[model samples]
Target: MLSVRSKAVASALVVFAATPVSFASAGGFGDLGLGNTDWQVGGFVFVAPKYEGAKEYEVRGAPFIAPTGLDNGTSRVQFRGPDDLRFRVLEFSGFEAGPLVGWRFDRDDNDAARLRGLGDVDGGVVAGGYVAYRGGPVTPFVSYHHQVSGDDTGGLIRFGAEARAPLASGIFVLATLGASYADDEYMDAYFSVTPGQSAASVAGLAVYDAEAGIKDVYFGLTTDVPLSDVWTLKLSGRYSRLVGDASDSPIVEDENQFFGGLGLSYRFNID
Candidate 1:
C-alpha cells in the first residue's frame, strides 16, 4: 500500500495536471489601463494528499505565467502552470475559442514505493480544442483532448462552468465546477492493473480493468487580491471525487481528494 505522503503527492500532481492558472482580464473594474497587452509572472506552493486514500501530504512549488491580449487585443495566450498551456485563436462578443495543449506527467516507482514493479507510465503530449461562452457573470466551456504522444492513447473530454464575484475592496472570488470523461485507452493507462502488473505487484493489489466512462467531478474556488498597482495575490482550494470505474480500481486508495495553493505575481502591460 502507498503511504499517506506518497498518496498526497500523486493527488497534487493530478490537480496540477487538470487545472490551469488564470488571471483577471484588463479593464474589468479597477481600470488600471496598463495597456492593450497584459501579463503576469509568479510562483505558487500547494499541498495535497498523495492519491485518494493515502494519509500523508505533499507540498510542491510551481511557477505561473499568463500573457493575454497579444495580437492587438485580438489574441490571448497563457502558460497555466507546468502541465497546462492554452491559446485563444479568436474572441468576439463574449465568445472565445482556441487550441489547448498540455503534457501529462509520468507515474513511476519513485512516486510511491508500492508502485514498484508496475512499470513506469511515460508522460505524453495532449492536444485539443476548447470553446467558451462568457455571457453575463457565468461562463460555460468544453474541450476535447487527444494524446498525441505518450503511453496513453485515446482522448478525454472536459466540460465546466465558472463564475466570479467581488468580495470586498481589492478582493474577488472565482468558482468553477467541472468533470471529465476518459476513453478506454486513457482510463486503462492510469487506473487499470494488467495481469502482468498484478503478478508483479508488491502490494498484492488485484487486477483491475478500468473502463471508459466519467472519470471524476471537481469543484474549485479562487480568491484574488490586488496588493498594489503592479502586484496581486491569489489563494485557491479545490475538491475532487472519483466516480465510475476509476473509483472501483483496486489501485485507488481514496475516492475523494483535496488541494490548496497560494500565489503572488507581478503584472505588466504593454501598449
Candidate 2:
C-alpha cells in the first residue's frame, strides 16, 4: 500500500505531466481548453425546480416507507463557479492550457450515498488543471480534479473527446464523451456497504464497498443560442453509467442518472 506521502507525490507527478496539454488549442470557450492565450474566467448559477428526476434512483423494501420508488427528491439547485486561466501554447495550431478551481453547493441522495459519508455534502472546493488539443473537428482532453476537502475527497482522472458543429439558425452544438477511473478511497467512502449490514440475507445479493475500482462512462450534448456576441444561452443534457463494484453495491442497486441543466454564459474578450 502506498503511504499518504507516496500517494501525494504520485498525484503531484500526474498533475504536472498533464498540465501542458490544456493549452495546446486556441479556439473559444466551446473548445476543450479555456481557449487561446487571452485568459478569461467566469461563473454560472443554475436551478432545476421542475426536474425532480434528474438524479434520483429507485429504492426497495423499506419497512414502513411504502417503498415509494425514489425518496428525498433533491430539487436541483446548485451554484458552481470556475476560475479558469488559459494560456496560448501554440499559435499555429491554436493550443492553450490552464488551471481551474470550482465549488458546488448541494449533495443529492445518490451523491450523499456516493459522495458524502453519511449525509448531504454542504459544499467543497475542487482544484485541478486540464490539458487539451484542438486543431480540427475532434478535440481530445485530459483533466484531473481533486476536491481539496469536501463531500468528494477523492481524485478523478478523466479522458474524453469533444466535437463541435454548426447548425441552421445560428445555433451551435457541442457533443462530448468521456470515461473515468477512480481509486478505492473515493469509491468506498461513497459506495461501500457497512459492516453490520447483511446484504445477502436482506436481498440475497453481495454488497461491494466503494473501494472497488469503478469505471464511469458519460456523454453529453450542449447547445448555444447566441443572444448577441456577448451573451449566449447554454443548455446541456448528460447521461452516465457506473460499473464495477460501485455498480453492484446494494445502496445503488445498479442505478443510472440523467442530468440536464440550463445556464446563461457570457463571453468576454471576443477578438
Candidate 3:
C-alpha cells in the first residue's frame, strides 16, 4: 500500500496530465511509475450531441487510452470511458477506487434555436471520485462529480453496471447502463427557465423551475473487432433519455439523444 501522502502526490500528477473528455468527446488512461501497467492508446472519431439536452448532433474525434494491471498480486485493472479519466490508487480483492476528473462542455443559447434565451453555461472542470468492483462477468461502479470551475452547475451522482464478453472469435462487446442524479444548481442551470429568460425567449418559452432529482438514464455499447494482432475496429454508440424536469423543460427539443462513431485503434495487449 502506498502512504496517504504518496498516493495524493501521484493522483495530483495524473490530474495535471490528463484532461477529461467532456460532454462532447470521450476518454483516456493510467498512472505513471505504477509498476508493470499494460498500456493501450488509440484514436477515435465519434459523433456526439453538441450540448447536453440539445437535439442537434455533431461529429467529433478524440483519442483513447486505457491501462490495466498485470494479473500480478500487486496490481489491479483500471477503467476509462468516453467522458472521464480515472486512475486506480487503491485495490483490494476485486475492488478498485480512485479519484476522477471529467470535463463538462457548457451550454450556449446558440447551441440550438430553442436555446435562444437560456444563455450560456460556462465549460470547466469537474472533480470527483469513484469506486468499482469487478467479479465474474460484470463490474458495478458508482461515481460523484462536482463542478470545480466554470458556471456553478453543482454536483452529479452517477451509478451503473457494465459487462464485457466475447461475441465471436477475435470480437467482443462491452456495454454499460447507468443513471444520473443532479443537485439543484445542476438541474437548474440548464433546465430551468427564469422569468427573464422566458421574456427573452424568441420562441416564447414559459418559465419553469427544474428541481433537483433524477435527470436521465443512459446506455452505451461498444463492439471491438480485431483487424490484426495489433489493430482493432471500434464501434460505439450511446443513447440517453432525459427524464424528470429535464425532459419537461421547454428548451428540450428532444428528450432522447443519441451518439455513434467508429474508429480504428492499435491495441497494446489483451485487456
Candidate 4:
C-alpha cells in the first residue's frame, strides 16, 4: 500500500512532467484554422471476448461473485469528445483545454455487484479538461478526470506522453502512457466483501472496513491504426496494481488486475 505521502509525491512528479509539455505545445490548434475552437464528437464500439478474473476471492474480494464481469458475454460501447479551445497560458507555447464528456454503455456482473450496494452503478461517466502542448510529433499532457457512477465517484490524475508516428500512406500510430487514482468508494463498491454474503470459494472473510483508500497506478498501451482518414482501429491494454489501504484489505490483499480491449473508433478533428 502506498502511503498518502507516497501518492502525493508520485502525483507531484506526474504534474511536473506533464504540465510543462502540455502548456508549451498548446498553440498548434491554430494550424487547423477551424475558428478559435470547435466541437468534436466520436464513438467507439468494442467486444471484450473474455473479462476473466485472476482470483475469484481476491480480485472481487467476494468469493460469491464470479470472476468475470460479463457473465452472458457482452460488448461495450463508449463515446468521448472535446471542444478544443486554444489559449496561450504558458510563455511561448500554445495551450488547448476543453470540456469533455464520455459514456460507457453495456452492463456486466461487476456492474451488478457494485449496484447491489448503491443506487444505480451500471456503467461509467468521464468529464474533465486536458491541456496539450503543440510542439513536435510527440505531444505531452496532463489531464484531470472526474469519473462518477451511481455508487462511486473519484478523481483520476493522469500524467503521460503521446506520440504520433507516420506510416506508409496517410496512416499513423498513436501511443500513450498514463496512470490513475481512485477513491475508497470505488473499492468498497466493487471489491468489498461482507460476511453472511454468499461466496463461491472462500467464507468467513469479509471486507468490513477497508484500511486504506482505493488507489491504482496503471500502465497502459494503446495503438490507433488508421482505417481511413476519419476512422481508426483502436486497441488498448492496461495493467493495474492496487495500492494503499485497499491493497491491505483482508479480502483482496494480493489482488492485481490486467485488462485489455479491442475497439473501432470514429474520430473527428474539429479544431
Q: Write the per-residue lDDT of candidate 3 for residues 65-158, one digit (tens) a residue.
A: 6542111112222334433456567667888788877666677787788888668888577788888887667889898888788798898888
Candidate 4 whole-model C-alpha lDDT, 0 to 1: 0.38
Report every candidate's CA lDDT: 0.66, 0.45, 0.66, 0.38
lDDT accuracy of residue 175 in candidate 1: 75
**lDDT tens string, model 2, 1-271?**
1111112222222222211112322234334433333332222222221111124332211011010101011101101112122232323354545565554233344332232233443335667766667677887877666677656657666788877677657665667798777776556555554553433233433445566353678787756566776555556566778777666665563446554544444445534
* Candidate 4, position 115, lDDT: 23
Model 3 alpha-carbon drift over 4 Å, by segment: 1-42, 62-82, 266-271
lDDT of candidate 4 over 1-271, digit per residue (tens): 1111112222222222111111122234333223323222232222221111223221110001001111010111111111111232233444445444443221234422322332233435556666666577666766655555433444555566666565556434445555444455545544455453324313345445543243556565544455675454545455667677556654453347664444443444434
lDDT of 1 by residue, 1-271 (tens): 2233323333344433333333334335333323437776776677765544333556766665564211122225443322335567667788988787776555665555566677887767778888888777788988888768867667888889877677886566667799989899978887888999989988877888999999999898876677888787767788889899988887766788887877777888765
Which is better, 2 or 3, measured by TM-score? 3
What's the CA RMSD for each of the models? Answer: 5.8, 14.1, 9.5, 13.3
Off by over 4 Å in 4: 1-92, 104-120, 147-149, 192-204, 208-214, 224-234, 246-271
TM-scores of the models, in the given order?
A: 0.76, 0.56, 0.77, 0.49
Per-prediction tally of clashes: 12, 22, 2, 11
Report the error of model 1 at residue 129, Å.
0.8
